[model samples]
Target: MAVTFVLAFGGSVLAQEQWVEFSSPRDGFRITFPGTPGIEDVTWTSQMGYALPARVFTVDRGREHYSVTVADYRGIEKLGIAKSQSCAPGAETCIGGQTRIVGPGYWKSDVHGAITYAVFMLLRRHGTPTGMTWNWAEQVEGTLLQFTNADQSRTSASIYMHDNRLYVIEGDVPKGTPEPELFKMSIGFIRPDGSGSNIYSHRFRISAACAAATLSASDRAPASRRPPGRVSGARTFPASPITFRSMARLPTAARFSRTTGRCQSCGGAGSSR
Candidate 1:
C-alpha cells in the first residue's frame, strides 16, 4: 500500500524544469545534492523465472527497494517487444492519448500500481484522491510513443535527459528498467478503445512504506555464492529465514549506547530501563 518513487537525477540543467541527459547505467548515473550518495551499482536478477531484485540506497544511509520482471508491448505480450503498427497492442493509444482523470483512491498514505500488467506502483502522492484520464498518442522519430498516464491522466515524462534540451521518450517502461514489484496487483486494465493501446507485464515491483531499516543479517555479509555460469558478484542474499520479537513484552537484557542515551527505543519513554 505504500508507493515509493525512484526519481533519476543525473543531467545538465536545461531550461527551467528540465535537464539535458540523464542518470543511467549505460549512460552513467549520478545525483549529488546535500542528500544521499549515488548507488554504487544496481544488480537485478530473476529466480525460477520470477525476479528477486535487490539494490542499495547509497543516496540515504539506510534505504532500499525491490523489483521484478514485466512485459513490454508491440505484438507478442510475452516477450514484451513491440511487434509492428498494424497490430495495435497494449497501452497503445488509450495510454498515449489525452484522457480525463477518473480513479479517486490516492487519498490514502501509500499507493502503488502498474500500467498494464497491473502491478508496478509509486507512492500515494502521485495520484489524486480522484482519478484522471490521458490521451498521449503522438509519434516522434518513427517510434510511436504510447504516452503513459495514471488515474489522474497526467502524462509521463521520458524520465531521461539528453542534449542541451530535455527530451521525453515514450514507450513501455523500456525493457529491463528497474521498478518495485510490491504493488503488482492493484492496477486495472484500460483499453477503453482496443485500438488506443494498453500496457501491462507479467510482474512489476512497487515501493513500500519507508521505514527505519532493521539491519538484516545478510546486509553485513558481502555477496554470497552465485548461480553457475552467471556473472560473479551480483550480490544476492541467502534465502535464510528468521524472526524477531519485541524486546518490551519479553524480559530482556539491558544495554547502553555511549553515543545515544536510548535502548533502540524499546522502553516506554525511550529512557534507561
Candidate 2:
C-alpha cells in the first residue's frame, strides 16, 4: 500500500508539471501553459471607449493563475465612422466630419497605443506596481510589469500588440514564488499561414511596414490561394481605405521572408530568448 501510494503521488506531481504549447490560430498567437486553458469570449472596452471583441484564455494551477487576453480592434474604424455620421450636421462635434473622426488615422493611433493602454489598466488593479519597463518578446516590442498584491502575492505581466491585436499575458502566483518567467517568455506570434516564430534579431515595433509586407505577399499568391479582400493576420479596414502611399509613410524594413518564415528586418537568425 505504501509503494502504491508513492507511485500515485509521483505520477500526480509529474502530471502537474506537464507543460504544453497552446496555439490560437484565429487569434494568431501561441503560448505555453502548465495545462490546457479555459477560453472565454468577452467584450473589452478600449481606452477610447470602443466595445471590442476579445477572448480571455486562463489556466489555474494550485494557487497560481495564468492568462492571455486578446482584444481585437478590427472594427474600430467602422465604429468611428458610424459615430461620426450620427452626429448632427454642422455641430461642433461634427466640425471636421468623418475626416476628423476616422480619417486622421485614429484607428492607427488606437493600435499604436494598445500596449500602453493595457499597461495603464493593469496599473489600476489591486496590486502595487513594483517594476515596469519596456520589454520585448521574440523581438516584438512590449511592456513588462511586476506587481505585489495587498495579500503579498506576486504578479508578472507582459503586454504586446501585434497586427492590431492586443495581447495581455499575465501570471499571478502566491507570495515568494519565483517570477513566472517561463509563462511570460513563451509567447509567440503566429503568421497567417499557421506558422509561428519565437526568434528575432532585434526588437521591432508594430508598424505598417510589416502589414504591407503581409498584404503584398497575399497579393502575389495565386488568386485561388489568396484570401479575398483581406490580409492574413491583420485586421481589414473596410470603412476606411488604407492607401499604400500612407503605408509607405510609416517606418519600413520588416518583411516576412518566405524561406526563413521570419521577419527579414528582425534578422531571422537569433535563437528564441
Candidate that scores best on lDDT:
2
User: Which sections of candidate 1 miss by over 4 Å?
Assistant: 1-18, 23-49, 52-114, 117-120, 123-127, 135-273
Residue 249 of model 1, lDDT score: 24
**Model 1, C-alpha of 46: deviation from truth (Å):** 10
lDDT over C-alpha atoms for residue 69 of model 1? 20
Residue-wise C-alpha lDDT for candidate 1, range 1-273, written one tens digit per residue: 122222222221122223112223322222221232233334322111212222332221112211222222111122121222233455433222221111111100010112311212222223332222332222111111122235323322122111101121211232233321212111122232423212211111211110112122233333342111212244222221111112212123333222221234334421233
lDDT by residue (tens digit), candidate 2, 137-255: 66577998999999999999999876667899999999989889899889989876679754321212336555557456555656555444433244431111222323323345555
RMSD of 2: 11.2
- Candidate 1's TM-score reads 0.18
The CA lDDT at 75 in model 1 is 15
Winning candidate number (TM-score): 2
